[model samples]
Target: MSEIRRFAAEARGGTPENDNRRVKDSVKRLQATVVEFNYLRSDGGRVWESSPLLSTCRIDERSGSLQYNFPSGLRERLVEQALYSMISLRVQWEFDSKYGLVLYETLKRYADRDAAQPWWSVKTSELRDLLGCRDKLTDWKDFRRRALDPALEEIDRLAEFCVLVIETRQGRGRGGGQVVAVTFQIERKPKEVAAATIRELEKPKVQRRGERKAKAEDIASTVDARKALHFLTGADAGTRLKWVKRAEAMGIELPKTASVVENLARWVPQIAAALVAEERIR
Candidate 1:
């Protein structure tokens, strides 16, 4: 390969000088860029896992020009056993929402066929961490509306997946349970790059037994359950006990022998409403 002209992505504070004749604007470069990568072992062996391609990178001005340097070993890996892919610069420039960016990369994890699964489950708490909204967007509904839904909409519109769906884990005896995890599905992949990705994905997954599970607090209960249960019966011990039996009779199953709040928070308020209606009619 031969060298070509290099220039800054944007001009460095190229506006009129201020009253003090000192440029008030600061010139800063983006901290990161997205890259898709493939990995191979020393003997040209396939590594069946998608790896994190983003690394510490910086732009330096030397010899009156800009230079890009990624962390050590990154260049060697790319040269020896890796290939990289990048999306359009305009696409990167136009993305405004942090949620959209978080999800866009998450979906990239499963963007290919054979190599990457079409759908994958990640813990919701892990997703919160990935989105950098940890501790801030704690409420599920608010997180979904303010960050997740908008991200989905924007990514579905602009990104390669075209459509991405997120659903809570529901199966076995776990239906209507707290959303401890999220499953992601992609409707379509980018035609331009997907062929290469699918070819890479044809490699088998490198098996490593017993990966550590994500650390999340046990989903002991829901907020609705607490208020509804309190409303169903007053603070009296006998009343709450009788109502628990009544709730069970209504097919509102609760986690057996869990904390009182845990049991109360598992089901909806329909059972309580039923008791209220019966009392009113009498």
Candidate 2:
């Protein structure tokens, strides 16, 4: 592709002749046309083939612009040029990930103490590197283990699945046109993550002691399994049964012939156990 550069300046000289001469000389040296091609036509029987060399020459007594068209394939050339640019970008990204950790940590510290930077300005190479390292460690540990661990196996399986996709894509015609489109996923497959990204899409669960506070303090001790059962019985039986029938009619998959009192009694121990460690249940 041909390189194009433009030269224009404020009319330092006094006369229009000087201006015209300078502009004419500049245009002549560039091998460019001063007149619009669309306006000019062949005289008599002559056929003037358009060279695709177009130019716009603005000659104001003060200052103006000189524009020109070089060739037809400029757009394709531009797109090809972008491929090299993106390659350079990917290289820079990898380099940034390896050596920019200190810079990232410093910026994060500043953000913690000061105003937050705009999202566009916040670099993510270091955080990505940290997460990648943690995942690699997790994989290494899994690989060395004797048993078939589900979490480790899931990671390995995902990796192999990706490799398979890549291989299949490469087998397609000509260039590997694997323009894989990715959407932001919540990373729910593993059901767990290391300390870093774990906070991103999930939060640490908080445990509460089994106690009723404030207004319910007086009734807390009395709200037990036996009392709960008696309360259910004393409540309008017809009303409770009607509510259950309504739930079934609404296509809600509820346990049949099971009262709320019976269901709560059966599940209370399990629910309490899950809320805290078994040793902490007391």
Query: Which one wins on lDDT?
Result: 1
Q: Which stretches of candidate 1 lie above 4 Å from their native place?
A: 1-63, 73-85, 114-117, 169-175, 189-282
Give the best candidate by TM-score: 1
lDDT of each: 0.54, 0.33
33-150 in candidate 1: lDDT tens per residue? 3443434579988564332344443333243233445545455656752132354454444455788876776576566545544876778887887787898979878998999887
What lDDT score is found at residue 156 in candidate 2? Answer: 26
| Candidate 2 local lDDT, 172-256, one digit each (tens) | 5455643222111112223443332334213211111122134254454334434444444455666446545654565545565
What TM-score against the true fold does each predicted structure earn? 0.44, 0.16
Looking at model 1, the pairs that clash are 115-201
lDDT, model 1? 0.54
